[model samples]
Target chain A: ALAAPALAQANPEVRWRFQSSFPRNLDVLFGTAERIASRVAALTDNRFRISVFPAGEIVPGLQVLDAVQAGTIEAGHTASYWYIGKEPGFAFFTCMPFGLNTRQLTAWLRHGGGNQLGDQLFADYSIQAFPAGDTGAQMGGWFRNEIRSQQDVQGLKFRISGLAGQVFQRMGAAPTLIAPADIYPALERGTIDATEFTGPHDDERLGFFRVARFYYAPGWFEPAARLHMMTNKRAYDALPDAYKAAIQVACAEADSEMTSRYDHLNPIALRRLVAAGAQLRFFPREMMQAAWTANEALMADLAGQNPRFRALWDSYRPYRNELFQWFRVSENSYDNFAFPAAAAAAR
Target chain B: ALAAPALAQANPEVRWRFQSSFPRNLDVLFGTAERIASRVAALTDNRFRISVFPAGEIVPGLQVLDAVQAGTIEAGHTASYWYIGKEPGFAFFTCMPFGLNTRQLTAWLRHGGGNQLGDQLFADYSIQAFPAGDTGAQMGGWFRNEIRSQQDVQGLKFRISGLAGQVFQRMGAAPTLIAPADIYPALERGTIDATEFTGPHDDERLGFFRVARFYYAPGWFEPAARLHMMTNKRAYDALPDAYKAAIQVACAEADSEMTSRYDHLNPIALRRLVAAGAQLRFFPREMMQAAWTANEALMADLAGQNPRFRALWDSYRPYRNELFQWFRVSENSYDNFAFPAAAAAAR
Candidate 1:
């Protein structure tokens, strides 16, 4: 109703540094940081600009939580799982073996009780978090020995992470931690029988297929992993509501783009990997059954002793189970019937 | 960069009317329009505002596209398939039977060639489209007489929409078009043997369970139906880049929220419906197989006759196929094993 002159208010310039756990070369991972920075700048007409720095520039890749908490940077972009050692409950925000997939986990965070539960944990560190991106279901691993049955995993030396490592230990595999750069050499030297990384895009870059012949499907351990933008609570709360709103909008786009990009690019990348002699196989049924059994036991055991983990798990598990039922009724049927029929038609 | 005085520019008072095809009663569908309007206004500090109107206040529910195109309204919230009779190519923007689910279709629009193909189709209508929301696969239908086999569908009278209607016709059901308000009465009087609606939340509101005993799974035709924000191209082009960015950001939020809200709300509603005596069932194997066959034939038939529809189908079908294969390898296995095991554990 009023003229522009009457409503005009001064736009304040706000600048902050955002550090990413991922390096610049991994476009889908690190690119989400760049996306948030640019979108925020555009949304606010450059009034609020966030400068993004890759891992190791300011802090080590996995130290993003510490950096954000210590206020070494205004914000940090990293997977929640990287700091699970800091709080075992943090794994719920990324994903777990047999956890909710992309949409399910996202629905949990955004709409279910997961976000509130997660923030309860984040508040302890004086950081505010928002989902910035997701890596869709990844490849399980590249294996030198294909596990045709549950017996094959017994005493197998596997290179994997902690939560999944515990599950593998339940299934009788000795899980060993190896750095990403060391994975290829380890596989070649027979120091690791199998190794898991990100999806085909990053895996192809790592050239794991050259040493490990059998590449498995469904990345059960990480059904779909999410990355977050962790803003120092002090920095985030000081922003004018409009600038804060801009951050919310921009972050939503990143939350969506990161996973959608993988969905788009991974298939094309997987084809290249297959053409280069990567053998795609489903993890044998017996191994998957054993892994599922172990996964449940591990969660129950963690819930029994860690009350904080129990608080998050209480919501995460029930929500996970409910969606599991819903997706099975809808998506599972659609994918099951549609994929084979379409593939058959093409053939 | 210059100081505050130089960069400060007026945010002009801009307003537009947004009409929604869905009624206010379907909160999730109509609520997205309200969300976008508020978000845009907030992002621009009330300088830009979109006034939302429910259907029938300005035009009938399905007239959104025409109103937006003819400039009677600046924008519309409607499913693209609502106007397929105006142009068959419109169906590709919405889901098709056995086509891509929510994430798969969304990825195509955001990253694959889909947005280009869709924009080409929309350009002719003088409308710019953005995905505003999605309904994760609808329930198959409420059946007065259950479809236990392929032959069970023969001569069955089903109140359903066009594309799926054609497939049902191929499967020998006499597809009838009845208004939503008339559907239940028709089924009650045996004028229709079954009726299709949205997922459990909306269906529960319609009280379909009172008349139809069997509610089925996997709405194959609308595996994940997307609703779009269709803006008049002329009105849209006149906006500043900042305003455009605001629309992009707000629509993304709506796109995520609408489906997630359903995912959050549906399971609770479904559990209630079951307690209210709704008999849940899967469409039998034979019926699903026959429906898939009919669906493929119908798509091919449309492709044969309508060159514009053919143009979109070529991109849509292959992309759908690619994602179907990818999802089957990941989500399918996870859901199949997890849903049953979790369900059994709960029991």
Candidate 2:
């Protein structure tokens, strides 16, 4: 029950600019930023408000980290892997090719050793990072043609990013990086034969189905892509403890809510894509096996070349392996048996 | 950044007694209540504080809802299915036999109309409920002997609860409901041949592995058990909007953190169990298939008898079906391909 207290000093109102890496149209991804901002404001009784800006408004999407580092904005929401060019270890914070799924990644970051390792790395850039959202297990990509074997991957031009790009390269395919806005045009103009983006909801909005008739899954490249909210270190440190806790709470809420939104909307959008004649196909077994091989080799190479990458990899790989073991016993077993039965019953 | 401001009107200070359904020894489950209380206090700058009381402190574990409904406590943290005697529909809010996993359940509750349905049913008891924690995809019960086929279940005496009890009963097994504290002794004394509790972390604490060497999984009976933080409707409504928002933010944080903690701790505990000579086994295919049949039949029977249960079932079943379809293409596909490879490499 509420009891009136002696008058106290008012907490100062604070406002922040939060730049999002995703465009305004990709609501599920970009909207996570809005949700965090509003929830923070609500929890703080409007004393702390954040104004969200989509890509290219304040700065380009890919430059969010730089903006946050330079205090161009007080905070920014973007995936950590996009800055892999800066450090190979950055990819682990987002997603790796065939890395941990959404829940595993969340556990590692929140409970396992991931957050400490992440903060240590992010501190170098003068930023404090928090996981804000996740796009659970992405679709492989939309393909102009069905891939039947490893030979189908040879010399095929693809638009992909992160370590997955390197895996593709090892498979003798030409991998190119393209911004989300440009992916559709590249596919449409035959510049790229295949491209991976977010899952059904955002993919449908970009009209990838109209351009590429074959929608392939599952996206081994970025199994579960996590978005991060990075605040300028000085700005973050200056906040009162209550406001700091509010930010953490807001980010956790957004992280959970965004994944649920994707899980709910992806099914509906997928149905629409199928109705519109987008053929759904699984990546061929041979292709998957070959990609797995390439991923293993590439990870080995990176670990040998960069000690920092090796440090993170040593911790990440084992944690991931343990998670894989546990999931096999629990999640994978139940899902493998029950899901197919449910599908057959629905049919 | 924070700045000084002139003194303003004092906000009301509110306090609530938050009762937990779990004993203090079961830290992971009961600890969620403490986390929520502290986070809410932190977010509200100590203006709103909730003091958590463990099971049997203010009232017995199973009487949480009754306490909240009778206004004996302002709030409670417990499982909805624990009160299934009040309404079968309450089972859906917690979990069901062969039901949705944690992520799917979270999606349904947050985004796929489940929250509204849950609130509508909870309104009858003058309670407002929010999901506070989840033990993600529990392991199957520890068994004294290996189950190799459907025939093995025919005369088994099992300790289980909720709809799962009925399913076991239909399988020709003698099913009994026992309190958590009593399960270890019951199994040790040969009163029950087997029992399903939460999972490895909690199971190890209860020393189930000592009594039963054959640890079978996955727990189809209760895939993901969600704990609820229920507030008395009058008390909840009377709170200032900011405090209400604080409660919500606190609950969401607790929900995410608990599952992450379980995912992290279970693996360590499982490894410890295995080292101590526990033989981990998968439920035989024949046993799983039979239990699935029993689950379906029992669900149909409940829906046929209760309109409210039917209403929630109609919605939950379809949402689950759609989620299954999506997971089949995304999570299941990736896991099936990758987990085995990871396992082989680890070996």
For DockQ, the strongest prediction is: 2
Off by over 4 Å in 2: A1-10, B1-10
lDDT over C-alpha atoms for residue A165 of model 1: 87
Per-residue lDDT of A1-347 in model 1, one digit per residue for the tens? 44234223435778899999988877778889999998887777777889999988999888999999999999999988877678889899888888888888888998888889988999999988998888887778999988788898998889997489889999999898776768899999999899998888888888899999898987889888888999999999988777889888888888878888888888878889889998889888788878888998999999998999998888888998898787777667766777787888778
Segments of candidate 1 deviating more than 4 angstroms: A1-10, B1-10
Q: Write the per-residue lDDT of candidate 2 for residues B1-347, one digit (tens) a residue.
A: 44323234324677889999899999999999999998988877787889999999999999999999999999999999888888989999889877899999999999889999999999999999999899999988899999998899988998887788889999999998888999999999999999999889999999999998899888998888999999999999998777899899989988888999999999999999999999999998888888888889999999999999999999999999999898899988999988898898889
For candidate 1, report its TM-score: 0.96
State the weakest 10-residue window (summed lDDT) of model 1 chain A: A1-10
> What's the residue-level lDDT of B190 in candidate 1?
90
Against the true structure, candidate 2 reaches a TM-score of 0.97
Q: DockQ for all models, in order? A: 0.62, 0.64
The residue pairs in collision within model 1 are none
Candidate 2 RMSD computed on C-alpha atoms after optimal superposition onto the true structure: 2.3
